[model samples]
Target: MKFLADNKRTLDALNNWVPNPIILSSFFWGAGNVDQRSIDGLLCSLLHQLLKAEPGLGPQLLTRYPEWTDRATYHDWSNKELETALFLAWDLPTRTASLSSLLPAAEAGIQGSMQTMHF
Candidate 1:
């Protein structure tokens, strides 16, 4: 699967490159919890968190965003809670999240946040 493919790419890139682990932050549309429904967004979100946490990446920082979920939803995701939420929301099968949805949602969320921050 492309998800695994991309994860492998990023992980391999991270593993082979021995350094202080500075993530080149993506121009993510928003902040707070990262959107991880797709590889592109996942890459950016991971980079953002990595950069935010690692002093070597840049200045210390944090992010905010919409459809709030954490970076763990990427590599560290577990399905049970989400499945339970779906079950509680509706006693029917839910469509998988769209790979296309993440960017626009993130953009809107970020724009809202930036406006709030008066940037």
Candidate 2:
């Protein structure tokens, strides 16, 4: 997966063939880091990438969850919140292609997460 992500020619070809394509890629580790393999972590990482690609989504996210910008009251984001944010980013008109590589052991949890998101 990393190889595919690093291939500029392939990425360029994909973008050319797909209209307004936004490529999102993520890799999960299974080195006993629960957070890295959790749905919350996955959503957070994807949301970060999405926001970087489209700053327009930031305003909407802030509007939906204003406390996100307030460190004083900031808490670990719930999976629901993160999922909602990801959905919002995903619902945009632009086409998005997601490529995720996860360890076999973490498949169930990740699949459950996607199911909840109706992905």
Candidate 3:
């Protein structure tokens, strides 16, 4: 949850502060998508900003998580990352209940095998 908290603070600052186009692009890049090149560009832009803001956090984070440089490989993130990204994207709103509410009922007859899998 610390990532989510930090992301929220970052967003709060963004809401009150206007960053350049490059930083804006990075924020959009954090939204998961299939385009590897675009994601890489965004990550680089974010790194640029982080380097300016904290100096050390950028290198520390990148050194610890080098996979972040490769969007194709990094796309399949762990649940924690997904949760953090969702929290960041949605302003840290309570999503557990809403997510459950949004699931289609079994009787809706969706045809995906993954949906029918049993834990």
Candidate 4:
């Protein structure tokens, strides 16, 4: 929930409880559109949010995938590429990025992604 992410008191408590203090969340609303509910879309949204929060990860990502260094073609992300990018973000040495996604229970595709992540 947004409250969990915005509440500073709770976040402070969580910071003491977890090694990696930063908490990020993404909410998925289908709005009756198939593309909006796909895993690729979720990855893109999550990656963008992650990059904004931790700009350091951007160079690491570029290091691994040199082709993406060019901003002109950065938007052309495939599903597999997005998944790989997320993995690379997670693999960063000092940064431990955590993401929570709110998915529609009825949307099987997104639900599958949650299951894959062991959520």
Candidate 5:
């Protein structure tokens, strides 16, 4: 939310950015398109990348929204949500589609970890 407030253009682009069509397709008839676990993992990996991209976002977010910054308040954000804000804080590189395109190491490492876990 802080990221949304701080960076309108990026948020708009993210909103307008068309998602990949295959992501909406189910493996079988009437089944979920993407499994929840895969979704969560992808989100987690993405957020981690976003935070790394914008190290200063967390501090600014906390400062602007102290209620959230204070744990006693509604600081119920999961790592994914927080990291998503960090990602949104970033300016999109020219013709950037996926961060993984620019940093293959991150995606490769994630795939390696998943394979090791057999998940």
Candidate 6:
């Protein structure tokens, strides 16, 4: 049980780093008609490239929107929901500023870490 719990926690943490389901779904929708295997391969390739180029962006997005745990689940989301999630994921500065304002604890934690890292 503990192992399962720990694994779930780790997977959840990792999901935070990956792209949201809606983004993935949008990409797939744009991929045009293709065999399932090829589509999967394309998506994997695109996701790999995205992660390589933007290291923490994936996790940051996942952290910002916990609803995007499973990519498949996003297929059912309304267009408005998808748009909102995409906006949040793509606009980090705005998200960060909003978060900093809404969550004083996050701001304090960041400040504390910055203070300790001073050379």
Which residue window of length 10 is worst by lDDT in model 4?
93-102
Q: What are the runs in model 2 whose C-alpha is more than 4 Å off?
A: 71-75, 115-119
Query: Model 3 clash pairs?
Result: none
- What candidate 5 gets wrong by more than 4 Å, as runs, is 1-36, 67-87, 91-119
Q: Mark the regions of model 6 whose C-alpha exceeds 4 Å error after superposition.
A: 1-52, 93-119
- Per-residue error for 72 in candidate 2, Å, reads 7.2
Cand. 1 TM to true fold: 0.21
- Whose lDDT is greatest here? 2
* Residue 41 Cα positional deviation in candidate 1, in Å, after optimal superposition: 0.9
lDDT of 4 by residue, 5-66 (tens): 67787577776776556666666665745545667666776777778778999988998799
Evaluate all candidate structures by whole-model CA lDDT and list the values in order: 0.35, 0.72, 0.34, 0.66, 0.38, 0.38
lDDT minimum window of 10 residues, candidate 1: 92-101
What residue pairs are clashing in model 1?
Answer: 30-110, 31-64, 31-65, 32-63, 32-64, 32-65
Clashes of 4: 0
TM per candidate: 0.21, 0.77, 0.25, 0.73, 0.31, 0.31
Residue lDDT tens for model 1, 17-102: 64333223233344445544333354444344443454342321212122224535534433333322222322222211111123
lDDT of 4: 0.66
lDDT tens readout by residue for model 6, 25-72: 112222334422232333333344444455676788678777766667
Lowest summed lDDT across 10 adjacent residues in model 3 is found at 93-102
Alpha-carbon runs more than 4 Å astray in model 3: 1-37, 62-119
Over 29-54, each residue of candidate 5 has an lDDT whose tens digit, in order, gives 12332322243345444444444554
Q: What lDDT score is found at residue 83 in candidate 4?
A: 75
Candidate 2 lDDT, 1-119, residue by residue in tens:
87876678657878887866677777777785766766667777788888888888888878877887763321366667777779987886556777777667464667867665533
Superposition TM-score, candidate 6 onto the true structure? 0.31
State in Å the error of residue 49, model 6: 7.3
